[model samples]
Target: MNEEVENAFLPMTSVSSGKGSLVIHDVYCYTNQIVNICFINIPNNKWVLIDAGMPKSAEKIIQGAEKQFGKGSWPEAIILTHGHFDHIGSVEALAELWNIPVYAHQLEFPYLTGEQDYPPGDPSVDGGLVSEMSPLFPNHSIDITEKLNPLPADGTVPLLSDWKWIHTPGHTPGHISLFREKDQTLIAGDAFVTVDQESLYKVMTQKKEINGPPAYFTMDWDEAKVSVQTLRDLQPELAITGHGVPMSGNELTRELNKLAENFDTLARPDSKT
Candidate 1:
Protein backbone atom coordinates (compact mmCIF):
# COMPACT_ATOMS: atom_id res chain seq x y z
CA MET A 1 0.00 0.00 0.00
CA ASN A 2 1.05 3.59 -0.64
CA GLU A 3 0.15 6.86 1.09
CA GLU A 4 0.40 10.48 0.06
CA VAL A 5 1.11 13.78 1.80
CA GLU A 6 -1.98 15.85 2.46
CA ASN A 7 -1.61 18.80 0.13
CA ALA A 8 -3.79 20.48 -2.42
CA PHE A 9 -2.75 22.30 -5.54
CA LEU A 10 -0.76 25.31 -4.49
CA PRO A 11 -1.51 28.71 -6.04
CA MET A 12 2.16 29.17 -6.83
CA THR A 13 3.44 29.35 -10.39
CA SER A 14 6.34 30.64 -12.44
CA VAL A 15 6.82 31.94 -15.95
CA SER A 16 8.81 28.82 -16.65
CA SER A 17 6.04 26.60 -15.38
CA GLY A 18 4.88 23.87 -17.81
CA LYS A 19 7.93 24.31 -19.97
CA GLY A 20 10.36 21.47 -20.66
CA SER A 21 13.92 21.92 -21.81
CA LEU A 22 16.52 19.36 -22.72
CA VAL A 23 19.78 19.94 -20.91
CA ILE A 24 21.22 17.29 -23.16
CA HIS A 25 19.77 14.62 -25.42
CA ASP A 26 19.31 12.45 -22.36
CA VAL A 27 18.48 14.90 -19.59
CA TYR A 28 15.18 16.79 -19.73
CA CYS A 29 14.09 19.36 -17.16
CA TYR A 30 10.41 20.10 -16.71
CA THR A 31 8.93 22.79 -14.49
CA ASN A 32 5.66 22.10 -12.79
CA GLN A 33 4.32 25.27 -11.25
CA ILE A 34 7.52 26.45 -9.53
CA VAL A 35 9.63 23.35 -8.90
CA ASN A 36 11.67 21.51 -11.48
CA ILE A 37 11.66 17.71 -11.97
CA CYS A 38 14.04 15.91 -14.24
CA PHE A 39 13.21 13.24 -16.81
CA ILE A 40 16.39 11.45 -17.73
CA ASN A 41 16.47 8.85 -20.46
CA ILE A 42 18.66 6.97 -22.84
CA PRO A 43 16.07 7.77 -25.53
CA ASN A 44 14.06 4.78 -26.80
CA ASN A 45 15.71 2.67 -24.17
CA LYS A 46 15.69 2.90 -20.36
CA TRP A 47 15.10 6.03 -18.27
CA VAL A 48 14.54 7.24 -14.72
CA LEU A 49 12.69 10.18 -13.22
CA ILE A 50 14.69 12.26 -10.75
CA ASP A 51 11.90 13.62 -8.58
CA ALA A 52 8.13 13.73 -8.60
CA GLY A 53 6.63 17.16 -9.13
CA MET A 54 4.23 19.32 -7.07
CA PRO A 55 1.00 17.85 -5.76
CA LYS A 56 -1.67 17.29 -8.44
CA SER A 57 1.06 16.91 -11.04
CA ALA A 58 0.94 13.15 -11.55
CA GLU A 59 -0.88 13.36 -14.85
CA LYS A 60 1.45 16.03 -16.10
CA ILE A 61 4.41 13.86 -15.22
CA ILE A 62 2.87 10.77 -16.79
CA GLN A 63 2.09 12.61 -19.96
CA GLY A 64 5.54 14.13 -20.12
CA ALA A 65 7.18 10.78 -19.63
CA GLU A 66 5.12 9.14 -22.33
CA LYS A 67 5.91 11.99 -24.71
CA GLN A 68 9.57 11.77 -23.95
CA PHE A 69 10.04 8.04 -23.70
CA GLY A 70 6.93 6.88 -25.58
CA LYS A 71 3.62 5.41 -24.49
CA GLY A 72 3.57 2.80 -21.73
CA SER A 73 7.19 3.41 -20.84
CA TRP A 74 7.69 3.57 -17.10
CA PRO A 75 10.91 4.53 -15.41
CA GLU A 76 13.09 1.79 -13.96
CA ALA A 77 12.74 3.66 -10.67
CA ILE A 78 12.06 7.06 -9.09
CA ILE A 79 15.07 8.69 -7.45
CA LEU A 80 14.29 11.36 -4.85
CA THR A 81 16.74 14.15 -4.07
CA HIS A 82 15.07 14.31 -0.69
CA GLY A 83 11.66 13.67 0.75
CA HIS A 84 10.56 17.30 0.75
CA PHE A 85 6.81 17.63 0.22
CA ASP A 86 7.18 19.31 -3.14
CA HIS A 87 9.77 16.86 -4.38
CA ILE A 88 7.88 13.80 -3.31
CA GLY A 89 4.38 15.12 -3.94
CA SER A 90 3.48 12.64 -6.61
CA VAL A 91 5.71 9.79 -5.52
CA GLU A 92 3.07 7.52 -4.10
CA ALA A 93 0.85 7.97 -7.09
CA LEU A 94 3.58 7.42 -9.64
CA ALA A 95 5.09 4.55 -7.77
CA GLU A 96 1.74 2.84 -7.45
CA LEU A 97 0.78 3.50 -11.00
CA TRP A 98 4.03 2.22 -12.37
CA ASN A 99 4.67 -0.42 -9.71
CA ILE A 100 8.19 0.88 -9.41
CA PRO A 101 10.52 1.41 -6.48
CA VAL A 102 11.32 4.80 -4.93
CA TYR A 103 14.84 5.44 -3.64
CA ALA A 104 16.06 8.13 -1.22
CA HIS A 105 18.79 8.57 1.34
CA GLN A 106 18.50 6.33 4.37
CA LEU A 107 18.57 9.33 6.69
CA GLU A 108 15.33 10.46 5.05
CA PHE A 109 13.61 7.17 5.84
CA PRO A 110 11.89 8.57 8.92
CA TYR A 111 10.15 11.30 6.98
CA LEU A 112 9.27 9.13 4.02
CA THR A 113 7.83 6.43 6.25
CA GLY A 114 5.74 8.92 8.29
CA GLU A 115 7.76 8.35 11.44
CA GLN A 116 8.74 12.07 11.71
CA ASP A 117 8.24 15.52 10.27
CA TYR A 118 10.65 17.99 8.83
CA PRO A 119 11.18 21.17 10.80
CA PRO A 120 8.56 23.70 9.83
CA GLY A 121 9.37 26.46 7.40
CA ASP A 122 10.78 29.74 8.73
CA PRO A 123 8.87 32.72 7.33
CA SER A 124 11.22 35.36 8.71
CA VAL A 125 13.90 34.67 6.13
CA ASP A 126 14.81 37.49 3.81
CA GLY A 127 13.55 37.94 0.21
CA GLY A 128 9.79 37.97 -0.50
CA LEU A 129 6.28 36.58 -0.06
CA VAL A 130 7.46 33.02 -0.63
CA SER A 131 9.62 33.17 2.46
CA GLU A 132 6.95 35.10 4.36
CA MET A 133 4.41 32.41 3.61
CA SER A 134 6.66 29.52 4.43
CA PRO A 135 5.00 28.66 7.71
CA LEU A 136 1.83 27.79 5.86
CA PHE A 137 3.55 25.21 3.73
CA PRO A 138 3.12 21.61 4.83
CA ASN A 139 5.86 19.88 6.81
CA HIS A 140 4.03 16.67 7.47
CA SER A 141 5.50 13.43 6.21
CA ILE A 142 3.48 10.73 4.49
CA ASP A 143 3.96 6.98 4.64
CA ILE A 144 5.42 5.39 1.55
CA THR A 145 7.34 2.58 3.12
CA GLU A 146 5.91 0.08 0.68
CA LYS A 147 7.76 1.62 -2.18
CA LEU A 148 10.62 3.38 -0.49
CA ASN A 149 14.19 2.12 -0.76
CA PRO A 150 17.32 3.67 0.64
CA LEU A 151 19.90 4.73 -1.90
CA PRO A 152 22.78 2.28 -2.17
CA ALA A 153 25.50 2.49 0.49
CA ASP A 154 28.15 3.21 -2.12
CA GLY A 155 26.61 6.46 -3.47
CA THR A 156 25.57 5.02 -6.80
CA VAL A 157 22.13 5.90 -8.10
CA PRO A 158 20.29 2.74 -9.08
CA LEU A 159 19.72 2.34 -12.83
CA LEU A 160 21.64 5.51 -13.70
CA SER A 161 24.92 3.98 -14.83
CA ASP A 162 27.04 7.05 -15.37
CA TRP A 163 25.73 9.02 -12.40
CA LYS A 164 26.60 9.06 -8.72
CA TRP A 165 24.48 10.46 -5.91
CA ILE A 166 26.30 12.98 -3.75
CA HIS A 167 24.96 13.59 -0.24
CA THR A 168 24.11 17.28 -0.30
CA PRO A 169 22.33 17.70 2.99
CA GLY A 170 21.31 21.09 4.43
CA HIS A 171 17.85 21.76 3.11
CA THR A 172 17.18 18.38 4.61
CA PRO A 173 19.32 15.80 6.33
CA GLY A 174 19.17 13.49 3.33
CA HIS A 175 19.24 15.93 0.47
CA ILE A 176 21.23 14.71 -2.55
CA SER A 177 22.54 15.83 -5.89
CA LEU A 178 23.46 13.79 -8.98
CA PHE A 179 26.72 14.10 -10.85
CA ARG A 180 27.84 12.51 -14.10
CA GLU A 181 31.58 12.75 -14.37
CA LYS A 182 31.67 11.69 -17.99
CA ASP A 183 29.93 14.85 -19.19
CA GLN A 184 30.44 17.03 -16.12
CA THR A 185 26.67 17.30 -15.77
CA LEU A 186 25.06 17.91 -12.40
CA ILE A 187 21.48 17.57 -11.29
CA ALA A 188 21.47 19.64 -8.11
CA GLY A 189 18.30 19.16 -6.12
CA ASP A 190 18.06 22.45 -4.30
CA ALA A 191 21.58 22.17 -2.86
CA PHE A 192 21.71 25.45 -4.67
CA VAL A 193 19.11 26.84 -7.04
CA THR A 194 19.50 29.06 -10.07
CA VAL A 195 16.87 31.45 -8.76
CA ASP A 196 16.27 33.49 -5.63
CA GLN A 197 13.63 31.09 -4.39
CA GLU A 198 12.88 33.41 -1.45
CA SER A 199 11.70 36.20 -3.69
CA LEU A 200 8.15 35.84 -4.98
CA TYR A 201 8.83 38.15 -7.88
CA LYS A 202 12.02 36.39 -8.82
CA VAL A 203 10.40 32.98 -8.48
CA MET A 204 7.49 34.03 -10.66
CA THR A 205 9.75 35.48 -13.31
CA GLN A 206 12.18 32.55 -13.06
CA LYS A 207 15.13 34.88 -13.04
CA LYS A 208 18.38 32.95 -13.34
CA GLU A 209 20.87 33.54 -10.56
CA ILE A 210 22.92 31.27 -8.35
CA ASN A 211 21.46 31.22 -4.84
CA GLY A 212 21.49 28.88 -1.88
CA PRO A 213 18.68 26.57 -0.88
CA PRO A 214 15.24 28.01 -0.31
CA ALA A 215 15.65 29.89 2.93
CA TYR A 216 12.23 29.01 4.30
CA PHE A 217 12.76 25.27 4.92
CA THR A 218 16.49 24.83 4.81
CA MET A 219 17.57 23.43 8.20
CA ASP A 220 21.31 24.12 8.09
CA TRP A 221 23.00 26.99 6.32
CA ASP A 222 26.44 25.70 7.22
CA GLU A 223 25.82 22.27 5.70
CA ALA A 224 24.24 23.78 2.61
CA LYS A 225 27.33 25.96 2.13
CA VAL A 226 29.54 22.91 2.19
CA SER A 227 27.28 21.09 -0.28
CA VAL A 228 27.53 23.98 -2.66
CA GLN A 229 31.29 23.95 -2.40
CA THR A 230 31.33 20.20 -3.02
CA LEU A 231 29.35 20.69 -6.21
CA ARG A 232 31.40 23.66 -7.40
CA ASP A 233 34.61 21.69 -7.10
CA LEU A 234 33.17 19.19 -9.59
CA GLN A 235 33.22 21.94 -12.22
CA PRO A 236 30.09 20.70 -13.94
CA GLU A 237 29.71 21.96 -17.47
CA LEU A 238 25.91 21.79 -17.17
CA ALA A 239 23.61 21.96 -14.18
CA ILE A 240 19.85 21.75 -13.76
CA THR A 241 18.68 22.82 -10.34
CA GLY A 242 15.27 22.17 -8.83
CA HIS A 243 14.22 25.74 -9.49
CA GLY A 244 14.89 28.29 -12.20
CA VAL A 245 16.23 27.29 -15.62
CA PRO A 246 19.17 25.15 -16.63
CA MET A 247 22.56 26.88 -16.25
CA SER A 248 25.64 25.80 -18.18
CA GLY A 249 28.98 26.66 -19.76
CA ASN A 250 31.14 29.47 -18.42
CA GLU A 251 28.12 31.04 -16.72
CA LEU A 252 27.68 27.91 -14.63
CA THR A 253 31.38 27.84 -13.79
CA ARG A 254 31.49 31.49 -12.81
CA GLU A 255 28.17 31.62 -10.93
CA LEU A 256 28.52 28.32 -9.07
CA ASN A 257 32.06 29.07 -7.93
CA LYS A 258 31.01 32.55 -6.88
CA LEU A 259 28.04 31.31 -4.86
CA ALA A 260 30.11 28.64 -3.15
CA GLU A 261 32.87 31.12 -2.28
CA ASN A 262 30.47 33.68 -0.79
CA PHE A 263 27.62 31.53 0.53
CA ASP A 264 27.66 33.06 4.00
CA THR A 265 27.06 36.57 2.75
CA LEU A 266 24.82 35.63 -0.18
CA ALA A 267 22.76 32.83 1.38
CA ARG A 268 22.84 32.63 5.18
CA PRO A 269 20.36 34.87 6.97
CA ASP A 270 21.33 36.78 10.08
CA SER A 271 20.16 35.83 13.55
CA LYS A 272 16.89 37.71 13.04
CA THR A 273 16.71 38.80 9.45
Candidate 2:
Protein backbone atom coordinates (compact mmCIF):
# COMPACT_ATOMS: atom_id res chain seq x y z
CA MET A 1 0.00 0.00 0.00
CA ASN A 2 1.19 3.53 -0.68
CA GLU A 3 2.27 5.50 2.40
CA GLU A 4 -0.21 8.26 1.62
CA VAL A 5 -3.07 5.79 1.30
CA GLU A 6 -2.04 4.08 4.51
CA ASN A 7 -2.29 7.35 6.39
CA ALA A 8 -5.46 8.48 4.67
CA PHE A 9 -7.49 5.42 5.62
CA LEU A 10 -6.27 5.12 9.17
CA PRO A 11 -9.28 4.00 11.17
CA MET A 12 -11.83 6.79 11.25
CA THR A 13 -14.20 7.60 14.08
CA SER A 14 -17.27 5.39 13.81
CA VAL A 15 -20.83 6.52 14.45
CA SER A 16 -24.03 4.53 14.91
CA SER A 17 -27.59 5.80 15.11
CA GLY A 18 -29.82 4.25 17.75
CA LYS A 19 -32.98 5.26 15.91
CA GLY A 20 -32.44 3.27 12.74
CA SER A 21 -30.82 -0.07 11.88
CA LEU A 22 -28.61 1.46 9.18
CA VAL A 23 -24.88 2.13 9.56
CA ILE A 24 -22.61 3.97 7.13
CA HIS A 25 -18.82 3.67 7.01
CA ASP A 26 -16.78 6.28 5.13
CA VAL A 27 -13.35 5.40 3.71
CA TYR A 28 -11.11 8.10 2.20
CA CYS A 29 -8.41 7.75 -0.44
CA TYR A 30 -5.51 10.16 -0.79
CA THR A 31 -5.22 10.43 -4.55
CA ASN A 32 -6.91 12.68 -7.21
CA GLN A 33 -8.00 14.97 -4.42
CA ILE A 34 -10.28 13.05 -2.00
CA VAL A 35 -12.13 9.85 -2.87
CA ASN A 36 -14.73 8.43 -0.48
CA ILE A 37 -15.86 4.82 -0.20
CA CYS A 38 -19.10 4.15 1.66
CA PHE A 39 -20.40 0.91 3.11
CA ILE A 40 -23.97 0.62 4.33
CA ASN A 41 -24.48 -1.91 7.10
CA ILE A 42 -27.82 -3.65 7.04
CA PRO A 43 -29.17 -6.69 8.88
CA ASN A 44 -27.84 -10.29 8.98
CA ASN A 45 -24.21 -9.25 8.88
CA LYS A 46 -24.75 -8.32 5.25
CA TRP A 47 -23.40 -4.98 4.08
CA VAL A 48 -23.58 -3.00 0.84
CA LEU A 49 -20.50 -1.12 -0.40
CA ILE A 50 -21.19 1.80 -2.74
CA ASP A 51 -17.79 2.30 -4.40
CA ALA A 52 -14.36 0.62 -4.07
CA GLY A 53 -12.18 3.79 -3.64
CA MET A 54 -8.58 3.93 -4.91
CA PRO A 55 -6.38 0.84 -5.29
CA LYS A 56 -5.10 -0.96 -2.19
CA SER A 57 -7.68 0.76 0.00
CA ALA A 58 -9.26 -2.70 0.25
CA GLU A 59 -7.32 -3.55 3.43
CA LYS A 60 -8.66 -0.43 5.07
CA ILE A 61 -12.16 -1.17 3.75
CA ILE A 62 -12.07 -4.61 5.29
CA GLN A 63 -10.75 -3.13 8.49
CA GLY A 64 -13.63 -0.66 8.59
CA ALA A 65 -16.08 -3.49 8.09
CA GLU A 66 -14.52 -5.46 10.91
CA LYS A 67 -14.74 -2.42 13.14
CA GLN A 68 -18.49 -2.51 12.72
CA PHE A 69 -19.27 -6.19 12.18
CA GLY A 70 -16.36 -7.81 14.02
CA LYS A 71 -13.23 -9.43 12.61
CA GLY A 72 -13.55 -11.97 9.75
CA SER A 73 -17.02 -10.80 8.74
CA TRP A 74 -17.04 -10.03 5.02
CA PRO A 75 -19.94 -8.73 3.02
CA GLU A 76 -22.18 -11.34 1.38
CA ALA A 77 -21.55 -9.59 -1.94
CA ILE A 78 -20.14 -6.35 -3.38
CA ILE A 79 -22.22 -4.03 -5.55
CA LEU A 80 -20.57 -1.36 -7.69
CA THR A 81 -22.37 1.75 -8.89
CA HIS A 82 -19.94 1.92 -11.81
CA GLY A 83 -16.59 0.66 -13.11
CA HIS A 84 -14.33 3.72 -13.02
CA PHE A 85 -10.78 2.86 -12.00
CA ASP A 86 -11.04 4.63 -8.66
CA HIS A 87 -14.35 2.94 -7.91
CA ILE A 88 -13.05 -0.46 -8.98
CA GLY A 89 -9.34 -0.36 -8.23
CA SER A 90 -9.49 -2.96 -5.46
CA VAL A 91 -12.55 -4.90 -6.58
CA GLU A 92 -10.75 -7.94 -7.90
CA ALA A 93 -8.40 -8.07 -4.93
CA LEU A 94 -11.16 -7.75 -2.35
CA ALA A 95 -13.57 -10.10 -4.12
CA GLU A 96 -10.90 -12.76 -4.53
CA LEU A 97 -9.89 -12.50 -0.90
CA TRP A 98 -13.42 -12.72 0.42
CA ASN A 99 -14.54 -15.23 -2.23
CA ILE A 100 -17.62 -13.13 -2.74
CA PRO A 101 -19.64 -12.41 -5.86
CA VAL A 102 -19.73 -8.93 -7.41
CA TYR A 103 -22.76 -7.18 -8.94
CA ALA A 104 -22.96 -4.41 -11.54
CA HIS A 105 -25.18 -3.21 -14.35
CA GLN A 106 -25.03 -5.22 -17.55
CA LEU A 107 -24.15 -2.08 -19.46
CA GLU A 108 -21.01 -1.93 -17.33
CA PHE A 109 -19.99 -5.46 -18.30
CA PRO A 110 -17.59 -4.35 -21.04
CA TYR A 111 -15.33 -2.62 -18.56
CA LEU A 112 -15.62 -5.20 -15.79
CA THR A 113 -15.14 -8.25 -18.01
CA GLY A 114 -12.13 -6.79 -19.82
CA GLU A 115 -14.10 -6.32 -22.99
CA GLN A 116 -13.47 -2.59 -23.49
CA ASP A 117 -11.44 0.29 -22.10
CA TYR A 118 -13.40 3.39 -21.24
CA PRO A 119 -12.51 6.44 -23.29
CA PRO A 120 -9.53 8.21 -21.75
CA GLY A 121 -10.17 11.04 -19.34
CA ASP A 122 -10.32 14.40 -21.17
CA PRO A 123 -7.81 16.55 -19.36
CA SER A 124 -7.84 19.43 -21.86
CA VAL A 125 -11.61 19.60 -21.56
CA ASP A 126 -11.51 20.90 -18.02
CA GLY A 127 -9.21 23.34 -16.21
CA GLY A 128 -8.85 21.68 -12.81
CA LEU A 129 -5.61 19.85 -12.10
CA VAL A 130 -7.47 16.66 -11.40
CA SER A 131 -8.67 16.89 -15.01
CA GLU A 132 -5.26 18.05 -16.19
CA MET A 133 -3.80 15.05 -14.43
CA SER A 134 -6.54 12.68 -15.57
CA PRO A 135 -4.29 11.13 -18.17
CA LEU A 136 -2.80 9.38 -15.13
CA PHE A 137 -6.12 7.81 -14.18
CA PRO A 138 -6.31 4.13 -15.13
CA ASN A 139 -8.65 3.24 -18.00
CA HIS A 140 -7.81 -0.44 -18.34
CA SER A 141 -10.56 -2.95 -17.74
CA ILE A 142 -10.62 -5.65 -15.03
CA ASP A 143 -11.20 -9.28 -15.97
CA ILE A 144 -13.75 -10.26 -13.31
CA THR A 145 -16.21 -11.87 -15.72
CA GLU A 146 -16.65 -15.02 -13.72
CA LYS A 147 -17.56 -13.43 -10.39
CA LEU A 148 -19.87 -10.78 -11.82
CA ASN A 149 -23.69 -10.75 -11.83
CA PRO A 150 -26.04 -8.28 -13.50
CA LEU A 151 -28.68 -6.37 -11.61
CA PRO A 152 -31.93 -8.37 -11.35
CA ALA A 153 -34.26 -8.11 -14.33
CA ASP A 154 -36.89 -6.63 -12.05
CA GLY A 155 -34.57 -3.67 -11.40
CA THR A 156 -34.28 -4.50 -7.69
CA VAL A 157 -30.76 -4.97 -6.47
CA PRO A 158 -29.89 -8.04 -4.41
CA LEU A 159 -29.88 -7.62 -0.62
CA LEU A 160 -31.45 -4.19 -1.18
CA SER A 161 -35.10 -4.77 -1.95
CA ASP A 162 -36.49 -1.41 -0.93
CA TRP A 163 -33.87 0.29 -3.08
CA LYS A 164 -33.98 0.57 -6.88
CA TRP A 165 -31.00 0.97 -9.16
CA ILE A 166 -31.09 4.05 -11.39
CA HIS A 167 -29.05 3.89 -14.60
CA THR A 168 -27.35 7.27 -14.30
CA PRO A 169 -24.65 6.75 -16.90
CA GLY A 170 -22.37 9.38 -18.61
CA HIS A 171 -19.71 9.59 -15.91
CA THR A 172 -18.95 6.25 -17.48
CA PRO A 173 -21.03 4.33 -20.01
CA GLY A 174 -22.89 2.37 -17.34
CA HIS A 175 -22.60 4.35 -14.15
CA ILE A 176 -25.58 4.02 -11.82
CA SER A 177 -27.10 5.32 -8.59
CA LEU A 178 -29.06 3.57 -5.85
CA PHE A 179 -32.30 4.99 -4.48
CA ARG A 180 -34.44 3.85 -1.55
CA GLU A 181 -37.93 5.20 -2.18
CA LYS A 182 -39.40 4.66 1.27
CA ASP A 183 -37.25 7.30 2.92
CA GLN A 184 -35.50 8.55 -0.25
CA THR A 185 -31.84 7.90 0.44
CA LEU A 186 -29.79 8.13 -2.76
CA ILE A 187 -26.36 6.63 -3.25
CA ALA A 188 -25.46 8.58 -6.39
CA GLY A 189 -22.42 7.09 -8.04
CA ASP A 190 -20.77 9.68 -10.27
CA ALA A 191 -23.79 10.82 -12.27
CA PHE A 192 -23.44 13.90 -10.08
CA VAL A 193 -21.03 14.58 -7.25
CA THR A 194 -21.55 16.60 -4.10
CA VAL A 195 -18.07 18.11 -4.25
CA ASP A 196 -15.99 19.90 -6.85
CA GLN A 197 -13.76 16.84 -7.15
CA GLU A 198 -11.27 18.55 -9.46
CA SER A 199 -10.23 21.00 -6.75
CA LEU A 200 -7.60 19.40 -4.51
CA TYR A 201 -7.86 22.20 -1.96
CA LYS A 202 -11.64 21.92 -1.66
CA VAL A 203 -11.42 18.12 -1.37
CA MET A 204 -8.77 18.20 1.37
CA THR A 205 -10.86 20.70 3.33
CA GLN A 206 -14.14 18.79 2.83
CA LYS A 207 -15.90 21.88 1.51
CA LYS A 208 -19.55 21.35 0.60
CA GLU A 209 -20.47 22.03 -3.00
CA ILE A 210 -22.64 20.06 -5.37
CA ASN A 211 -21.24 19.73 -8.86
CA GLY A 212 -21.06 17.53 -11.94
CA PRO A 213 -19.20 14.22 -11.99
CA PRO A 214 -15.41 14.26 -11.79
CA ALA A 215 -14.53 16.16 -14.99
CA TYR A 216 -11.55 13.94 -15.64
CA PHE A 217 -13.68 10.92 -16.55
CA THR A 218 -16.99 12.33 -17.61
CA MET A 219 -17.44 11.54 -21.34
CA ASP A 220 -20.87 12.64 -22.54
CA TRP A 221 -21.75 16.07 -21.27
CA ASP A 222 -25.33 16.11 -22.58
CA GLU A 223 -26.10 12.71 -21.17
CA ALA A 224 -24.61 13.74 -17.85
CA LYS A 225 -26.91 16.73 -17.68
CA VAL A 226 -30.01 14.62 -18.27
CA SER A 227 -28.83 12.18 -15.61
CA VAL A 228 -28.51 14.87 -12.97
CA GLN A 229 -31.99 16.10 -13.82
CA THR A 230 -33.41 12.59 -13.54
CA LEU A 231 -31.92 12.14 -10.09
CA ARG A 232 -33.24 15.50 -8.95
CA ASP A 233 -36.75 14.42 -9.88
CA LEU A 234 -36.40 11.60 -7.39
CA GLN A 235 -36.01 14.26 -4.71
CA PRO A 236 -33.84 12.11 -2.49
CA GLU A 237 -33.82 13.06 1.17
CA LEU A 238 -30.27 11.87 1.82
CA ALA A 239 -27.42 11.36 -0.64
CA ILE A 240 -24.06 9.63 -0.27
CA THR A 241 -22.15 10.32 -3.47
CA GLY A 242 -18.87 8.79 -4.67
CA HIS A 243 -17.02 11.82 -3.28
CA GLY A 244 -17.51 14.30 -0.44
CA VAL A 245 -19.33 13.87 2.84
CA PRO A 246 -22.86 12.45 2.74
CA MET A 247 -25.53 15.18 2.77
CA SER A 248 -29.17 15.29 3.77
CA GLY A 249 -32.41 17.26 4.25
CA ASN A 250 -33.50 20.50 2.56
CA GLU A 251 -29.92 21.51 1.89
CA LEU A 252 -29.34 18.56 -0.45
CA THR A 253 -32.72 19.02 -2.05
CA ARG A 254 -32.02 22.67 -2.73
CA GLU A 255 -28.61 22.03 -4.24
CA LEU A 256 -29.95 19.24 -6.42
CA ASN A 257 -32.67 21.52 -7.75
CA LYS A 258 -30.21 24.25 -8.57
CA LEU A 259 -27.97 21.75 -10.32
CA ALA A 260 -30.84 20.45 -12.40
CA GLU A 261 -32.03 23.90 -13.38
CA ASN A 262 -28.62 25.12 -14.47
CA PHE A 263 -27.13 21.84 -15.63
CA ASP A 264 -26.25 23.05 -19.12
CA THR A 265 -24.41 26.03 -17.69
CA LEU A 266 -22.75 24.23 -14.79
CA ALA A 267 -22.13 20.77 -16.26
CA ARG A 268 -21.18 21.64 -19.83
CA PRO A 269 -17.72 20.47 -20.82
CA ASP A 270 -15.22 23.29 -20.86
CA SER A 271 -13.88 22.26 -24.26
CA LYS A 272 -14.46 19.56 -26.81
CA THR A 273 -11.63 17.17 -27.44
Each prediction's RMSD over C-alphas, in Å, is 1.8, 5.5
TM-score for model 2? 0.86
Off by over 4 Å in 2: 1-33
lDDT of 1 at 271: 49
Candidate 1 weakest lDDT stretch, 10 residues:
1-10
- lDDT values of the candidates? 0.87, 0.72
**What is the per-residue lDDT of model 1 for residues 1-273, given as tens digits with 9 covering 90 to 100?**
122245432548999877787879899888888899998885459889999988778998888788777898889899999987789888888999999999999998998898998887787788478888877777778788999999999988888878999999998999999999999999999999999998888899988999999988899888999999999999999999988899999999999999998988888888432
Candidate 2 global Cα RMSD: 5.5
Give candidate 2's whole-model lDDT: 0.72
Q: Counting only residues 3 or more apart in sequence or on different chains, how many pairs clash (N, Cα, C under 3 Å) in candidate 2?
A: 0
Candidate 2 residues 184-272, lDDT tens each?
Answer: 88888888877777765665566778998888788787788889999999999888777776778999999999999998777676474
lDDT of 2 at 230: 96
Which ten-residue region of model 2 has the weakest summed lDDT?
A: 11-20
